[model samples]
Structure formats: C-alpha cells, structure tokens
Target: MNIDVGILANARNECRKLLTEQVGVLGVVISSVDGFDVASAVTRDLEPAKIAAMASSIAAIGIVVSQEASLGASKSITVNTEDGFVYITNIELAGQLCALNVIANSSAILAQIIYHSGEIKRRLEVS
Candidate 1:
C-alpha cells in the first residue's frame, strides 16, 4: 500500500480516458477524499480543482448522512436530471479515498466507467 503521486496521477489519467472514451462522458474528475482535484477533463472555464474540493465535501456529507441512516457502505451514488446524469464513485487506494465524477446520459454507462476505474485503481494500488 505504498501509494505514490505517480500512481495517483496514472489513476486519474485512466479515469479521464474511461469517461471520455468508454462512457461518453462530457467531463470527468478525480479528487482527493478531502476535496482536492487530482486530475480532470473539463472545460477551461471550469475550475476542476474547485469542483473536486466541492465534490469531496459533498461526499463527506453524503457519507455522514448515509451512516446516520444506516445505509451501510457506499459503493457509488448517482444523481439524475433532465439535462444529464452525474455519477460519483469513491476510489479507495491504500488508505486514501478519491472521488470519481462522471457526467453522462445513462446510468449503465456510468456504472461501467466506475467499474473499470475501480479495476484500474486496484491495479495501481497493488503494483
């Protein structure tokens, strides 16, 4: 579990690729558990670092709420809207948690992205 910065960077790159190429996602971000952006594939106007920090905060709140409600371990969370869908998956590497956000049309596609991202995380963590 000797996670390095390079490993995290690779994970983020893989996440971006999965979202753009596999899931047809408009944007993707990998953020620290505390809400710092590690990597992102967003427009220039959008501050990915800020978004990552906000997402991490939201995830913290979500986790607390889930815990309070006895929702058990959170695998992933999805928010759907008329415009599109937002999916978030908690990426646990070593002892740190990173959040992956995928903006897409279909939940199935997002799930696939998250699944693949998880696999990538596992590989990076062990190797």
Candidate 2:
C-alpha cells in the first residue's frame, strides 16, 4: 500500500489531467507532507518544487490550527484570494499522508476536484 515514486509519478499525471479537464484549473500539484513535489502541472512561469514546499508549509499550519482548535481531523483546507484560490487536502494512502493542491477561481469546482482527488487517493491506497 505504500506509494512509490512510480505511482506518485502516475498520480501526478492524473492530477494534471483532472485539474485541466474537470476543474478548469491552471496549476495543480501533488506534494509530499514534507514539501516535495510528487507531481505537478504548472505554467512555465511557476516553480513546481517551490510551490510544493510552500504548500506543505501552509498545510502544516492548517493541521496545527485544526489540532489546536479541537476541530478534529481536517480532510481538506482552502484559502481564497483576489486572484484565485488554493486548496490543500490530505491524501491518505495506505496510512501514509500526502498532500494535494489545486489552484483555481471557482470554489465549487475546486471542492469537487478535491473530493475527486480524495477518491483517487483511496483507490490508490486500497488497490
């Protein structure tokens, strides 16, 4: 059930396709909890590795906040901004936690994308 580099690589490609087709997303990245890029689809102007690292940092903060507030477990976290939004969710595969990020404008679409990504994670874990 442990996800290896090859699986992660495949997952990244799937994520990119899902983002582009399903969510009308511009940038998408699947990162490790420690802030390493597992997969990404981004423009040439962006740096995937750096984005992954930053997203991991942000996810860590969200986890801490959720823990401290007694919010219990958080399946996903979203941040909205003037330009777009950032969604980060925990991809629990075989007891291992990875992070998936989607950048988009529509909140509803982003939510659906996150949900779908979670499903993907579950499938990966189970299969």
TM-score of each: 0.77, 0.81
Best by lDDT: 2
**What are the runs in model 1 whose C-alpha is more than 4 Å off?**
1-3, 43-45, 105-108
TM-score of model number 1: 0.77
RMSD vs true structure, all candidates: 3.0, 2.7
| Model 2, span 1-127: residue lDDT tens | 3567667666776776766677456677878889888778875666778889999999899888989999998678888877677878887544577788877765446567767777767766664
For residues 1-127, what per-residue lDDT tens digits would candidate 1 score against the true structure? 2457787677767766765576456667877887777767864456777778778777887888899999997767777777667777787665677888766665346557667767766775675
Cα-based lDDT at residue 93, candidate 1: 60
> How high is the CA lDDT of each candidate model?
0.71, 0.75
Residue 61, candidate 2: Cα error in Å is: 0.7
* Count of residue pairs whose backbone atoms collide, per candidate: 1, 0
Q: Best by TM-score, which number?
A: 2
For model 2, the stretches where C-alpha displacement exceeds 4 angstroms are 1-5, 93-95, 106-108
